[model samples]
Target: MAKKKKKQKPKQGHPARLQQGVVSMDRVKVGRGLDALTGQFVQWYAEYRDDPELALMVLAAVRETLGVYAEVVGLNKVTDFDPPKLLAVLNSMIEFEETENPEAASNELGTMIYMAWVDYVEFLRDTNQWEREFESLDWFQKTLEAQDPFAGEDEVEADDELDAILDSEEASIAALAEITAMPISTMGRAVLSWVLAGGSSLWTSLPIDQFVETAAKAVENDLPAGLEETRKGLAVALVLQALEAVNAVTLNPQAAPERGVRSQDILEPEDADSFDVNFYFIQACLDMLLEQPGENDQAALEAWGLAALWIVEAADGNPQHAAAPRDEQWSSEVWKTAQVRMHELRVLGLLESGEAYSLPNIVRLAVTDVDDDIFEEDDELDDETLDAIFGPDDVDEPKRLKRETPYTGEVLQLKLTLKDSKPPIWRRVLVPMDLNLGDLHDIIQASFDWYDGHLHSFYENGFGGTTYGPAIAEMDYQKNEAETLVSSVLKKEKDRLDYVYDFGDNWEVRIDVEKILDADGGQLPRCTGGRRMAPMEDSGGIGGWEAKLEILNDPDDPEYEEVAEWCEDFGLDDGEEIDPAYFSKEEINANLDLEF
Candidate 1:
């Protein structure tokens, strides 16, 4: 017995799309990029805010720079652009001064906070550095700055509550703001929320300053509500855990390390909250829609749609993917999902016309009756492609090749042998005159075993044969081209010979040609596309041939004797030798001048 091989199952995990690495504080690539500012504005956050602003800028810059890097560089590094949920998706709004803009949608919540802090700190230090830098950028400079790399995290974690060691109350409050900026919470509880939700991280022990400002924003922003909100965070974490369940999303340490957090883990099967844990989970799906719209499948489409509806409904329309105004269609996952499902329904033949194409059309196509393997393709070509390859003038050719010939017309023969049949009985045919390269193709079809559906092209000789040329396809040939069958090939004396394809179904198949005419026969005429119609009685067909044959008498009827003898005598043979006695001496004399 043959041993059965096991099919390899797809492994689980997210392919890291984002890239991150540790850098020493001293040797890191560059620092404080936006030190100079163009005039025109306020320095309230920096001059008046001072210490709190410094702490804020540290994180603000980290977040902002990471975000800018994401846009210019793209999200390909972290999650292979897969989807996930962020419980903080709601909280992320607080970081942005304005969330409703399209061009603004590209702004990183972290970057916005960082730049805002930078603006504030610079002013406080009596330094207009970053603003000046930002001001001097030409459009080209802005584009280049947008691609700058992520800032280093000092290669060290506080390892302890960073907020507790702060000095004044204002500074403490600033730490609280910064705390929320990072996920400082712990293995789970958003540290900012840990402080807000009553679970202690380092924030609880911090001076009164920490909670003052951001806590006010936290309460004012009112991200979700109660444990329902924290529960939402837990829910998202569960999604991440489920990455191990379905086994498609895993951390890509090799490609991207800790920052490699991916889609599968973002929305793991067993996880709770779903999006509140991390918005990128869903954003990843949306990212896919953004990057590649035509890749959506049934499973992926459904998952994305449901997740979009959930996030939108759960957020009550206040989506993190949304910026300030909340009306933008491209920025909302719910809006994006709805667009895709509509496409799926439309293509599935579920929806009617009138609407424009959506991102889902880009993600997945609709299917009616699919076999188990959705990817298998059939061997039929679409009409558009057929028209394209052959072109209107070719498939619908209006011209024919004209050839001059001697009085006696040319003839070609074809023979076929089957692989399994014993003795493989077959049929033969001979055709006449003025026929060009394309004409021989049809004559061969009429004389031998051919299929109804396959396309065919014919050659006069083998590969390079001129007169007979290659048959267009195997099953069917052009009638116009088939009209002028060649008796011989046009070979050049330069005799620079090259290899060519020999025709027919396979190696053993062969053909022969003969040219002979009585000296008294009139000169051959040039073939026009014009040709006499095929006799209705000549073959079995839809209306006449098959019906006519069914009602015709048998060959033994004696009346049919003439027809049978004509068929046998006129047919071409497979290179068979003919007795001289069967032909006049004139034929043998004419052949004496011929050369291969």
Candidate 2:
């Protein structure tokens, strides 16, 4: 994830919404005596009443430490922000200094104590004490001289207490685990607590040795013992332990060692080849689900139901060649078990009851029992539903020319295909002459049900050519999307352009204008045709989607059940067979209404 640099000056329009929130460290609540550290600092600051320079220096040290901690956790923006917590930390550190040196409390003295505590703790967290560079007090003389104002009191007592805390094996391990598991929301508070505890000499050791020991005990695999004697070995062990905890990857205890244990012990899983596919597919589905408001419960339930049905249907199809590691193919038996599992989930309150899908309107939708002319008034729709249907205040109606006939435009019928897709997945969209490239992007997204969560760009000469999209303040662009008309780039039939969205996923759609309408006026921009469901969002582009298809086709693959379960979770693959070539012009038009 790229962290965008903050702009120096405010932009003209509304501020851009942050893709993610900055984790507030103030939310973390540290354990034990750490809680009282703030109160102590407040009291100490009051004691040093005349020492303004001392106060500034002390405050700066606290702020600097918090900033360093934030950067360590990848929260760069949060470093210099959150004044309330900084103030609290400043109070605590002063209070801590007062208790340590009541007779000779100076700004220079307090800053040294605070800096020493912070650097030492961070050092332990980042590296081991056995490493030569782990001497945290290496900066003791420099920091004091840099901020020289008065002859400072000795910090030997404070250093001694810090050393005592670092020497305690159990205390440090517990603190590290808590730090590592700190939730994003509570990180700030938790970090403050650690600093407070360390200042009080409550925490005395680092968790590296303890974590390594724990991993050795829990994992059945023969962990390399040779690395225990070397700094490099311990570093590798530290990383491996973290990986093993998450199960992102695993290690083999019995693999024959050629060069060393590091070479032979780390083992790749059977699905390692498609790790990106599985990771991206699951993450995309989750991201898609999260983007919707919680009030959309009914729609969410329908999606879940549909996904369940898709899985059941795929399992029953018994297609050849599923994902690897398992060979039990999809069969009637698998379908039966899936049904049982679904029922059990409902009974256990894990899945919603059948009532979720039992509404009359939903039933009608399931059976496609609505009127043939979708635009015609529906006799079955209730007064409230009818009112909702014709709700004028709900949408911003697009302006159209007042013509005796429909507003006519030169229509370009374009085919958009997923690059490198097997069996070729694509969408056909009709673009109006007046529609700008920006709106065209939206129409394409609507055709494929993409959530539009990532950045997109249109290229004049396909993939690597001149691009135009949203403009960033820091960069110059060849073209601006909102002002660039679709017709301006491709006026004639058979002309083409390339559209890519979600740069990370690199989903490239080839837009080829197959036919141009001479006099036709109908709904200007609409889906004319499409093949297959657009690959799940973030399914690692075409390759990941294909891998997922392979898993769905084969029931016997070890990952088949897992893949099927995943589809059900997102309600993507319901038991009902979804035709890969299915296209509904009415449905497409309905979506266009929402978009336009």
Candidate 3:
């Protein structure tokens, strides 16, 4: 008879298995504060539990609010509740909602969450469990009152009419025609006057009648006077709105078109806070606007010039007083000055023109023109002069030739190794040579189970070489990663690239082209092999990772419990100690299939 296998004993502190998909709470651990809080919550919940709908609503609100707080702050006790912490959580929710769904005026889920917190706080006070007397609910009440739908119903209705007019293309065209008919000098002077009176702020804050009156005086035109009740008034209003919109876009490229621009976004040259930079940016925008012939472009330029002049006027006081009187000679001098500024702006890569007429939408301004002719050898200049102009001889290296493509069915087997990782945490992936760098970035993220919550970049040669990444305002990049194909950078078996994610932690990966092979007709861009688990994001880089591994390896370590808890929080643990050498090729490939 075969010997019977002995039943293995369960390990100490092992979590109980789920029964019928229900998690067993018998083995779950709860902190003293959490236990007390829950006990009170249960009693409070019982009061409304008779009405199932109200009870469910309360439960969901409480769960979502507490859940987000726990996710953001790792809140494990009632003592974690504080005004600043709550404020941070609230801001995160608002920013996320705004970014994900810009059309929504307010986050309803966030409102519910706040309401739940208020109720919980009230419960704590009634039960006499509240110890932080300084934390007030008055601010929360005021915020809720401000968000009340009925508070400003009439004002909202009035604004709706103006908003509709602004949204209408026909109205915009009429307004543009009116603006274009006015002399450029008149427009410039109006802008100057508007700037002296306090730019967009004063205009946006005034009543409609007052704003129309002010606009008329600035333009020295009688068209907008007493026309606040007519179509002409709407034209004036549209011009003001367009000016404000252009100003908003100029200061912050990321500012949403529909939202009200903040005062903080506007940088005054007289403020001494990065004044020179702000002033130059404004000048660059004006120069760019002048390059295009679109009526909207001209109008935007006038608005921008007004802003620029305002900065100058505010700094030095009434630029007209400096005395080049309005004349044909004065106009020529002004034109020459603008030309010089335009050339400077272009050389700095701070200004560029698009194919169509639109508002001045500037993004990704480079400090220095990467393709400047100074890098090219000059036959007229001697070696010393050439060296002075071009820095050094070694810097004038030949540019890499891009691969000529009518891409064949080619696959690149890439080996991505985490930099400075001992035992070399790595992954082997097969990707199509024609795939864009952005998609490759996604594959890399998925392979390592990275959250992709931070900024990332690909360097063609190395960190200081040609950069490929998302286009961010004021950031210089050689090409957009989403538009650059992998073959453009890596065309051979041995070609390599470097990638870095999370600038703070600086996690680096070196990607090498290990093999060039013909396509096998299998699913492309799939992971073939990898070793070890990826380090948790924000784990303080390699040094912190090493320390974490040391603690994880030894259960008896003083900080092992805390470290294990953190791992659980990040979903790195599944009721078992995390293995340092863990890797699953099938799992990675499955994820890659889903991603690709």
The lDDT of each candidate is 0.29, 0.44, 0.51
Error of 2 at 348 (Å): 40
> Which candidate leads in lDDT?
3
Ranking by lDDT: 3, 2, 1
Residue 577 local lDDT, model 3? 64
RMSD of candidates 1 onward, in order = 28.8, 27.7, 25.1
Give the per-residue lDDT digits (tens) of candidate 3, residues 390-438: 2233232212332354335889999999999998899999989878998
Q: Residues 51-72, candidate 2, lDDT per residue (tens digit)?
A: 3335445444544545333322
Tell me the lDDT of model 3 at 543: 76
In candidate 3, position 579 carries an lDDT of 67
Ranked by TM-score from best down, the candidates are 2, 3, 1
Candidate 1 global CA lDDT score: 0.29
- Residue 575's lDDT within candidate 1 is 30
Model 3 residue-pair collision total? 0
